[model samples]
Each structure stands twice: as structure tokens, then as C-alpha cells.
Target chain A: MLNISNIVLEIFNILMKRIVLMGVIILMVVATVYLWLSNSGFSEGEGPYLGIIALILVFAVFLLIRRIKSWKVGEPQEDELSKKVMVRTAALSYYVSLYLWVFLLYMQDRVTFDKDRLIGIGILGMAIIFALSWVFHHFRGVPND
Target chain B: MTNRIKEFRVKLGLTQEELAKKVNVRRETIVFLEKNKYNPSLRLAFDLAQILNVSVEDLFSFEDEK
Candidate 1:
């Protein structure tokens, strides 16, 4: 009654669950890129709407990630090592963002750049670094149960 | 901080994954423990000892740390 196929499928399922949040993030990034590429620039009708779309996507991604983590393994997702990794991620992201901001400010004096876009990109950079680092560390450390 | 976790686990014929599942930790945690690279929390020490059917002192020897 070993049911080797069932065991293989079960392992596959856990691997899928582990990458679920990362997959969603990738899809969202692709959608945003597609949107940006199709338009010469945010048109009058779409400019304001882009902000709303970004906001909605951000919230949706946040909620979905939390849901997936909490439900994974039916155990508390934030263990001691996870907390430590998160704290480390946050600290590293802060330093990275700080350096990036300084570089952006320096480049601003040399060329005309949209301040809003630069700020948005800076924030996005920090968020992606923190999120990806956290996920990488957690998954690398996760027990293969 | 050296311990006999691996020895006891092997004696019981448990894989790292099985022991990790029993302790509700990741397999990496067990690997680190076996290599004496990670120290266990007091609760984890108790859990491991209970799982191995041995007292904490029997599982981990700390005189070397002194």
C-alpha cells in the first residue's frame, strides 16, 4: 500500500506550494511590463488608472502571499529562523535603498528624469529585494517534510 | 555543544526528513544539528530527547563546552 505515485504527487504538490507566491509575483511583473510596452506612455485615460492598478496589485499580492504562507504545512509560517531572515532582509534592503537613492539624486542633477517614476522605482527596488531575499532564505531553510 | 543526535537518530532508523517532521522543523535544521553547527533551543532539546526516548543529558554532552 505504499502508493509510490501518490507520494511522488504529494512531493510535487509541496514544491508547487513553495513557489506559488513567487509565481504570482512573476506573472504580475510580466503583466506590468506588457502594459508599459504596449503604450507609448501612460495616456490621459490610462495614467491615473495605472496608479490604481498598481495599488490593487500590491494589495492583492500581499494578501495572497500571507494566505499561502499561513496555510502551508498547516503550521505557523513565521518561525524563529524566518523572523531572523526577515529582519536581515529588511536591514539589507534599507541599506540598498539608501545607496540607490543617493545614486538617483546624483543622476538627477545630470539629466532630466521624472521624479515620480524615479521614486516609484526606488521603492519597488527595495520591496523586490526584501521579498525575494526573504523567500529565498526561507525556502532554502525549509524542512523537506 | 557537541551532541549525539545523529547517532540516536540512526539507531532508530529515522531519516532526516522523518525526524524533522516529528520535530516540526525543516530537514536543514536536523542536518545542522547533526553536524553540531546549530544549537538547539531548550524546547527543541527536550523534544529531541523525548523522541529518542532518552534524557537530554544522554543525548547531548556539554562538558567539552566548558
Candidate 2:
């Protein structure tokens, strides 16, 4: 199910979907780790998240052995500049996420969305914003001024 | 802020990749630094200056925005 092939176009579609699913899972792991680490201390609610991240990392490593080719095992990926970029991106995303929350709060009375779904949307929006902001800063660099 | 990192690096016959490797940063960081778009940390500036064999003052200068 995970194998990608050049010869068979039909099976390739299925494999591509699987690959994308794996990628999303990895991204979720990154988001979870970022949020967990950014917090001052671990809460009881975070215990399950830690377990989830561990399981995801193990699965990701298994995938890495067979599928991913770019990343090396045990090699450090982040550098000093990348760290700076992440810090800046995280700070920027926090401010933007507040507006999203305010909008959600504003919509609570008008919109029929369930409380759980609304909270889920807010979390997803934060992740997407963080990812996009990180990409922007990674390529463009944080503004000197 | 403006930096002469590219000038000094070229004089030392080092590519951006090589300099980044020496300084333990990504090559993109060097590209941004050379373009004067990123203000590097003091430690990074010191490390880069040392690698390029230039003083930090010679490598980077700040222009006050009036």
C-alpha cells in the first residue's frame, strides 16, 4: 500500500494518497510537539499527547526506512538560523491566531457550529497558520527592520 | 543593517554551502545574510566574522533608521 511505482499508474494513485496521509500524520506530530514544548509545564491533558507523539515517531521511523529518502537517521536537521526562523514564526502565528479566536468568538452566537467543532477548527487554523508562516520566514528570512 | 559577508567569503574562496557548513547553519541563512535581509544574532555574527577572517565591525554595520 505504501509503495510508489512509475510503471503502474492506477496503483500509483492509491500509493500517493497513502503517502500524503503519512505526511499529514508527520505534520500533526510536529504541531503537537511544538505546542507541548511551548507550554510552561505538562498538564494531565497532555499525557495522551506525549504517547501519541511517541507512537507517531515510531511509525514515521518505520516509514523512513522504506519510503522517505531525503532525511538521514540521527543527523540533526535544524540549524541556528532555522531555530531563529521558527521562534519568529511561532511569535507571529500567535498574534494572528488571536484574531482567529476573536472571529470564532464573534461567530458563536450567529453560527450553529458545535462547541467541539469550533474548538477543532480553531486548532486546525492555528496549525495551518503556523505552517504557512514558518514557510514564509524560512524562505524570506525574518525582517531586519 | 548591512553586511559584507559575501565579499569576505568570496575573498576567502569559500562557497555559501562551505561557509554554512563551517558555521553550522543552512546555506539559505548565508544567502539572506548576504542580501542584508536578516539580522543575525551577535554570536552568529561573531562566528561568521571569524570564519571570514574579518572583524565583526568590518563584517556588519548598522545604519540608523531616521
Best candidate according to TM-score = 2
How do the predictions measure up, each by TM-score? 0.57, 0.63
Q: Model 1: clashing residue pairs? A: A143-B26, A143-B27
Docking class of 2: acceptable
Candidate 2 lDDT over A39-115, as tens digits, reads: 85777855764664555466465654434331222122455667788898899999999999999999998988789
Model 1: per-residue Cα lDDT over B1-66, one tens digit each: 678999999999999878877887766567867877666778888999999888999998775433
Give one digit per residue, the lDDT tens place, for model 2 in B1-66. Answer: 898999999999999878887887667778888988788888899999899988999998888888
Clashes of each: 2, 0
lDDT of 1 by residue, A30-106 (tens): 68767775876656855644664465457447646764655464444444555555676677778777887888889
In model 1, the Cα lDDT at residue B3 comes to: 87
Q: State the fnat of model 2.
A: 0.53
Instruction: Show where candidate 1 strays beyond 4 Å.
Output: A1-26, A41-79, A110-112, A131-145, B61-66
